[model samples]
Structure formats: structure tokens, C-alpha cells
Target: MKFNRTAKAHWKGGGKDGKGSLTTESGVLKESHYAFKTRFEDAVGTNPEELIGAAHAGCFTMQLSFFLVEEGFTAESLDTQARVYFEDGSIPKIELELKGKVPGMDESKFKELATKAKENCPVSKLLNADITLKTTFES
Candidate 1:
């Protein structure tokens, strides 16, 4: 199977002073505002790193759900957070933290499956940085 997704960005002026808007084909991010402050400083807007973190978290969680189903278990809840570590103008690593509640799943099994998901998720595979997973399972 194959799928294609498109996102557009528009920027004006210099790198440090320029402002931009991001739009995805799905309209989920219709003209979302972003700028140098948003990326480097604590500005109240979206940035590429934030977007990448969201995408990685979403992909890994969904992949873990599939693995859980295959293992004859269903998660009551799964919360994942992805932290992109950026340094020297590059992303050095991404950390995926997952907390999940699955009625009949063991901690070891949950960790195993989450690790597999972190390795196999499309976004995880796409990134050229070190990826790590930390899992917390609740009964």
C-alpha cells in the first residue's frame, strides 16, 4: 500500500525575523503560525520540532495498539510523549515515553511491544537520530 501526504510552509523576511505559516493537506494545521521565536525561544506557536514530536508520538502509539491487538490484548488507555533533542543545528535523539493501562497485560510484555513499536513505527524509522522508548504499564 502507498499513501501521500503534503504540507506547505510560507515564510517572509530574514531567518531570525521572518514569520511563517504551515498548512497540511488534511487541514488539521491550516495556516498555523510559526517563527524564529517559536522554534528557538518560548513563543506561543508551533514549530517543526514540536510537529515532529507530535507525529512520532502519534505513529508510535498507533503502532503499539496494533501490536497489542495482535498479542490478544487491548489498551484501556495509552499516553505517549515524544521529546526531540536538538543540538548543534541537528536532532540528536528522540525519546518516546509511554504510559498505558491494559487490563491483562504484564509490564514486561508491554515494554517489549512498545519497544518493538518504537523500532518499527514509520516515523521512528524515518528519523536519522537515536530513538529510545520508556514504557510504564498500569493494571
Candidate 2:
């Protein structure tokens, strides 16, 4: 199976005075500028980086949930947060933290599943950021 996603940006003027608009092939539109703080930061909308983090966290959580269920563990809930750090002259880093309540999964097993999800998620493969994952399981 194959799928494609597209997002485009249009910018005007120089760096500090420049402004832009971002639109997804899916039809989501956003306004952006340096003063707004990101690709889309003003009354316009969220930035690409923020959207990336959101996607990563949501995808990772769903993958982990499925893996846990396949292993005969049922989770009450799973919450994941991702932090993406970008440096001008350096590679970006993404840190993922997840907390969950699994009825029958021990910490060791939970950690294993979490690691697997982090490594195997599609977003993980797409990211150039250094990815780090930390998970906590509650019984």
C-alpha cells in the first residue's frame, strides 16, 4: 500500500520582514511569519514542527496500544508527549515520553513493547531527529 501527503508554503519579503502561508494538499491553510514564531504561529495556526510532534506522539501511542493488545495486555489508557528540539547548526532531537495503565503487562514487557513501537512507527522512520523514548507502565 502507498500513500502520499503534501504541504506547501509561500513566503514573501526577506527573513525578518518575510511572511508566509502554508497549505496542505488536504486543504488545511495556515499563515506564518518570523514574528509569529514558526511556519504558522499567529492567529493563522500551528507550525510544522508542532504538527510533527503531535503526529509522532499520536502514532507512537496507537502502535504501542496495538502491540500491547496483541500480546494479551489491555490498557486503560495511554498518554504520550513528544518534544522536538531544533538547533540552528545542529541536528534536531525528539524525545518521547509515555505513561500508561496496562492491566496485565509487567514493566519489563511494557518497556519492550514501547521500544519496539518507537523504532517501528512510520513517523520514527521519517524523522531526521535523534529519537529517544521513555515509558512508564502502571498496573
lDDT of 2: 0.80
User: Model 1 segments beyond 4 Å from truth?
Assistant: none
- In model 2, where is the ten-residue run with the lowest total lDDT? 32-41
Residues 1-139, model 2: lDDT tens digits: 7988877778787865666676678764544332244543345456657778988999899989889889998889899999977578444899999999988778999999999999988999888889999887787
lDDT of 1 by residue, 65-116 (tens): 9999999999999999999998999999999999999989899999999999
Candidate 2 wrongly placed segments (more than 4 Å): 25-36, 39-45
In angstroms, give how far residue 118 of model 2 lies from its true place: 0.6
The residue pairs in collision within model 2 are: none
Please report, in order, the local distance difference test score of every candidate based on alpha carbons.
0.95, 0.80
TM match of model 2 to true structure: 0.79
Which residue pairs show backbone clashes in model 1?
A: none
